[model samples]
Target: MIFVTIGSIFPFDRMIRAMDDWASAEGRGEEVFAQIGDGSFEPRHMRWVRRLDRGAYAEAMASSRLIVAHAGVGSVVTAGELGKPIVVMPRRAALGEHTSDHQVETVSWLRGKPGLVVADGEADLPECIAAAAAAANAGARLATTADTGLIERLRHFIHG
Candidate 1:
């Protein structure tokens, strides 16, 4: 299943709407499910809930073949730890989706990380999703542990 989530703090209607439209256009509605948050735009093509409980949320992530979500650190980190491929769409402040454009900056910083793909705008979502799904289907996976270099650097920074 393709699990789509907009974190608990804010409503991300644009991302939700884009995914909903993509599901409809691709005829993959049944395969898509969403945790939409407080978004005003209800998904017409796929199943969705306003919010998911912790257990349910974890289950959805665990079972999904691909995860589509807003560019939040928690979601990105969890996806990496779970070895799941994720497509992230940053919430834009210019659209009043957040208090600032930090999400966009976060996406920029996370650009080349394993198992994470960025959808810069609604129009970019479909292609990003497709690429992430294809990679997942091809057995590409994120490492469940931190990179060796990162770990070593942290160790040195802390203990030196």
Candidate 2:
């Protein structure tokens, strides 16, 4: 299954709509499940709920083959910790999805990371999702912890 989540703090109607459309168009509606948050746009092609409890969310993530989510730190980090493949679409400030374009910055830094795919826009989601799924099938997986070099750099920077 493809698990689509937009986090809990904001309503991401645009992401939800794009996923729903993709599911319908690809005829993979039955394989997609979304935790849509408070989005007003109801998904017609795939199964969805407005919110998921922590346990349910964990279970969904554990069971899914590919995760689709907004570019939030928690989702991305959790996907990494679980060694799951994820496709991220940052919420845009100009589109009223966020207060700033920080998510875009996050995506830029994470673009080439293992097991992560960055979708530049809704138009790129289908291809991004497909690529992530294919990578997962080929045994590509994210790290479960921060790299030792990164941790050492942070320690040095903080101590100095």
Candidate 3:
């Protein structure tokens, strides 16, 4: 199963529409569950809900073979912790998806990281999804933990 999420704050119709179109064309027969947040476009090829609760979200992440998500740190971090293969499509400000291009910057930084792939646009999503699925099937694991030193520093900063 593929779990698609666009986070909770904004509507990412472009990503949702692309994924729907891709799924419809691919005929992979994989079950896709999407968490679309206030998006106007309804997915025709995949099952979707307006939002998922925390427990439901966690369950979806844990059960999914691959996670297709927006380039948001929360989703990325959760997917990383779960060792899930994740394909990220960043929301663009120019397309009215976001107030800024932070997602683009986030994707830029996260590319090449283990278990993470960047789909720069709809054109790249199919390939990225295929790669992610293959990697997952090959028993690839994402780097879930930060360096010990960084962790300690963060702890110290929080405690101090």
lDDT of 2 at 135: 89
Q: Which ten residues in a row have the lowest lDDT in candidate 1?
A: 136-145
lDDT of 1 by residue, 74-119 (tens): 8988898788999999999999999999999999988866678899
Error of 2 at 31 (Å): 1.3
Candidate 3: residue 74 Cα off by (Å): 0.6
Q: For model 1, what is the alpha-carbon lDDT of residue 156? A: 100
Q: Write the per-residue lDDT of candidate 2 for residues 1-160, one digit (tens) a residue.
A: 8899999998999999999999899845458999998878999999999999999999999888889999999999889888899999999999999999999999999998879999999999989988998888888887777789999999999998
Q: Model 3: runs farther than 4 Å from truth?
A: 148-160
Write down the TM-score of every candidate.
Answer: 0.91, 0.93, 0.90
Which residue pairs show collisions in model 3?
none
Candidate 3 per-residue C-alpha lDDT over 1-160 given as tens digits, one digit per residue, 9 for 90 to 100:
8999999999999999999998898836888999999989999899999999999999999999899999999999999899999999999999999999999999888988878889999889999998988887788777887878999999999999
Cα lDDT of model 3 overall? Answer: 0.92
Order the candidate numbers by TM-score, best to worst. Answer: 2, 1, 3
Local distance difference test scores for all models? 0.89, 0.91, 0.92
Q: List the residue pairs that clash in candidate 2.
A: none
Candidate 3: count of backbone clashes, pairs at least 3 residues apart or interchain: 0
